[model samples]
Target: MSETTQRILPPTEALICFNLYAASHGFIRLYAPYLERIGLTYPQFLVLLTLRGPEGEGQPQGVGELGALLGMESNTLSPLLKRMQGAGLLTRTRSEEDERRVVIALTEAGRARAEAAAEVPGCIAKDTGLSEEDYHTTLEVLRKLRGQIAGLDGKPATE
Candidate 1:
């Protein structure tokens, strides 16, 4: 093929997506034991974390709101919420003012579980061996990249 027509693809090791995918798996593996101890899957743990406020208080929220915050669709989040409710980790109640809305709140058990898992982040951070500064910087960069990528979903590929 002519030089202009030749398509050269970078090796997998040199691809950003490949590195991100591998790092995500590694992070999940690091979280596995801690999550298991808290009787949670990673997604379940994320739910608890999102439901918690900065001050460590559980914030009661509508199911739709919770799903949005977690970047989950209702169809996917519903079954997980149901399972959590069954496990006594949370309560799902019809909103008093809006029957169509289901509100989610952490039960005492769920709060306790969240507290128990509080150290998991620290553990995972330490395991990564990244300095505190580097860790925060990396997290910031990843979040920015994720947002930018997500924004491109409906846009033309060339853009």
Candidate 2:
């Protein structure tokens, strides 16, 4: 279909939320092949990439902490964590000071996998067909949009 023709979306199809939702799925599809080679799903890769702290530092994060950072629910995240643990990607244990808190630390294998997947961003960027400037601008716009939406709760976005 021509670009101009595709622009004539139905009212329901014209929603920004729907576009964002579709884009998210497109992103997952784009990343899936690369992630598969590394034995990670898109969400699994996200968890590992987040946990792969500065310079491959395996910082221990509590389950709640990870949940908050990822904007995920503990109930949904727990099973994923268990799978990663079983796969030897990370270790999950109760905090010594607070047994109620479950802390997660990336295993060396997981760190290695994260490092290996570092080229993923470059690959995605290259495939996006957007100029570097346009890509960055889009990211900035999206970040601002997210902040503004989040701040609709009457809290300052900077907070």
Candidate 3:
């Protein structure tokens, strides 16, 4: 067979992107039941988690702020925020200081839900079946990789 026509096994193991993508899907599946019990999808849960501040406070943020934090666009986030608002999980209000800016805040119910969902990280860590050392090591590597990629676009890592 010509080199161009030769068929070889796919190098799935060699592709970091593929591994990361697949792992994310796996984690989503694992998290589905937990999220469903609380009437949330993965992304919705992420939004609630992000809105929560230190000591369970709800930090009011703007749509732009949330989009920037989640790496999402307004077109996508607006509908999601609306859905959450409809569900009484959060509220979006026009800023008093800036009429053009909209601020988002979690409701009391949202705070309780977020607190309830805090156990998810522990569940995920347990599901990974990795030792504490390996888990931290892998997390650090991924964080560094994300930082490097962000830096390529002239944006520093958030931390």
For candidate 3, write residues 56-139 as lDDT tens digits. 667899999999988899999999999999999999999999999999999999888888777787888898788999999999
Against the correct fold, how does model 1 do in TM-score? 0.89
Higher-scoring candidate on lDDT, 1 or 2: 1
Candidate 3's TM-score reads 0.85
Write down the lDDT that model 3 would get.
Answer: 0.87
lDDT of each: 0.88, 0.86, 0.87
Worst 10 residues of 1 by lDDT: 1-10
For model 2, how does the per-residue alpha-carbon lDDT over 13-69 read when each residue is reduced to its tens digit? 767789889998998899988999988988788788889865677688999989978
Q: Give the top-scoring candidate (TM-score).
A: 1
Model 2 TM = 0.85
Better of 2 and 3 by TM-score: 3
Q: Once superposed on the true structure, which residue ranges of model 2 sit more than 4 Å away at CA? A: 1-8, 153-159
Q: Highest lDDT, which number?
A: 1
- The TM-score values for the models, in the order shown, are 0.89, 0.85, 0.85
